[model samples]
Target: MKHLTDNTLNEYLDHTSDERSRKSVKDHLNGCDACQTKLEELGKIFAELQIVPEVALKHDLTPGIMTRLNLETPVRIWTRTFAAQAGVASGVLYWLASQLIPFVKIPQVSLSKAVFELQSWFAQLLTIQVSLPTWQIPDIASLLPKFNYQAPTINLPFSTVHVISLTVTVIFLWVVANFILLRSRPQVQR
Candidate 1:
């Protein structure tokens, strides 16, 4: 006769075994002294576990666990102030560009001529004997101590390079301001 397994004996002691398993375990235990002793030991263990008090958790751990497992999605929050600032900045940049265009002296030149000039300029810069114009401002004397009279002037041909530089400056400022605002915004995750 084969003796019942410890699991089957434990299940029988706990009254959790199926009818067929209960009958088989009971029949084996009744005839087998070893299985009966093992069942008694398991019964004592179960009784001890029942006497021990269950402890309550201090905090809910579902959110932390879910976040660690990447099961939760993060939400980005944009403030009203950030949105307003961005809008104002965009409007200012647009206004500045529009107002400055009429003031800038851009000579009417054909597309082919402009491209040729740009290429020739690059060639001139690359050559050892670069002949770019240099601006010299006259020194101003201090007429009044409080006012400190000063005159500074810069003269250069406003070409494609100047336009590109202005455009790049505006773009850089926009990118930097937006980046700062984005970092300041809050992010929430469940």
Candidate 2:
């Protein structure tokens, strides 16, 4: 005869076993000392587990969660008016630097001339033309659609002062924005 299973023993100890199952376990336990011992051990363990103290947290973590979720925390007021004024000053400085910087005579670059030189150098370095042996190559120029592509002339007359001013303006705006953002959030104490 099969001895009582752990599940059967546990259910028996918990008083949750069905009548038929309980009867089978009781009949087995009558002859089996091992099953009776196991059931008593499990019952003691269950009792201890039921009596273990429930843990209580010292601090509530709901506010931190709510702040991260942007649900409960109110949007802080714009108190950094001085920082905003500094950003305006920075913009003014950028405009002043652009105007006050002495003009330097910069050599203008012709893109068409550069392209022609590059093409000549490549042509001299590597021959792209194919000289096939008796394979009557169909004229690709005729096979393909005719393309007359003239690259648009892009002339950006940006001086050194213009470049510096542009850089300063971008950096100034970025720094000011970061300062305002960092100062705006309310510091949560742990």
Candidate 3:
């Protein structure tokens, strides 16, 4: 029988050899003292590797990696979450407006009339005889479901101006709220 080579012994010890190769190495090892001694030395080296502990990391690298990779910072994500929340809130408010605005009693044939009239008044003061387009203002109330309930009516004046102004205010509030929300969050250190 041929003597087992160092590669064959190492492969057998590492379990990388196929069944036939391992069987051949084992058969040869029984008769070859030199190969057996080499196998023992390899085992001792492997044992020493486990006996000594692995070196610890020199420094924490996760933050540096995240920054260099241009990954989204955790703080921005958390802060911008409020923008989504504000959008949801706006949707709820619009739904409420659709529902509750119908309850307010008002008489109207057109809603845009108020805005046109205002434009005309401004034009008249400027001595421009503006042919303002006739539009329905304060008439959106008619589009809403009629006040049929016997509940105590919250009698409030309804007009295109009031609703338009409020709509603008809400929109402005949403923008400011989001801007402030992001700015108020603490800066994250890399």
Candidate 4:
């Protein structure tokens, strides 16, 4: 026959055992001397524990405990904001690329010119006709007339240098903006 478990004995002692459990444990204890002894020992321990006085804490240890556990440490809000901003910036750049794709004209080259250019490129020679594909912003010139606005004619020759400069400027501005955002955020307390 299986003797009463420690949990059963404790539950019986604490009066937390159900009526059926109490009756079953009582029957087992009557026939089992080992179970009876174990129950008595548990009862004595419980009684002794009840007499012990509860002491108040001298210091609030929650912060120290949480710090050690690192459970309550707040995440840097700027990191999330920076990631979201980067995603949005990338999306805008992609949209701008799509809008400009229609205007980009890859100049048709003759077979002789193409062969010469390829040979020159291989030889690392100058006088290489670097015809950049022309790209324009979507129908802004046409839209201006509909809106009764005259588009300003700026005679700035768009080249690879201009595109590179524009890209570098945008990246520099984005970096500065992120740096400012990071610095402006409040520091998390330990």
**In candidate 2, what are the lDDT values of residues 28-88, reduced to their tens digit?**
8889888888888888999999998989999999988866767656655444665677788
Model 3: how far residue 51 lies from native, Å: 1.3
Clashing pairs in 4: none
Q: What ranges in model 1 sit over 4 Å off?
A: 11-17, 55-114, 123-190
Q: Which ten residues in a row are the worst by lDDT in model 3?
A: 143-152
Residue 68, model 2: lDDT of: 74
What are the per-residue Cα lDDT tens digits for candidate 4 across 53-136? 989999999889966655666665467656887898899889988877666665555778767656655555343344445783
How much is the lDDT of residue 42 in candidate 3? 92
Better by TM-score, candidate 4 or 2: 4
lDDT preference between candidates 3 and 4, better one: 4
Q: TM-scores across all candidates?
A: 0.36, 0.33, 0.39, 0.45
Q: Write the per-residue lDDT of candidate 3 for residues 85-121, one digit (tens) a residue.
A: 7788899989978878767765453548756666665
> Where does candidate 2 clash, by residue pair?
none
- Tally clashes: model 4: 0
Better of 1 and 4 by lDDT: 4
Each prediction's RMSD to truth: 14.3, 18.7, 12.7, 14.6
List the global CA lDDT of all models.
0.70, 0.72, 0.71, 0.73
Ranking of all candidate structures by their lDDT, best first: 4, 2, 3, 1
- What C-alpha lDDT does candidate 1 achieve relative to the native structure? 0.70
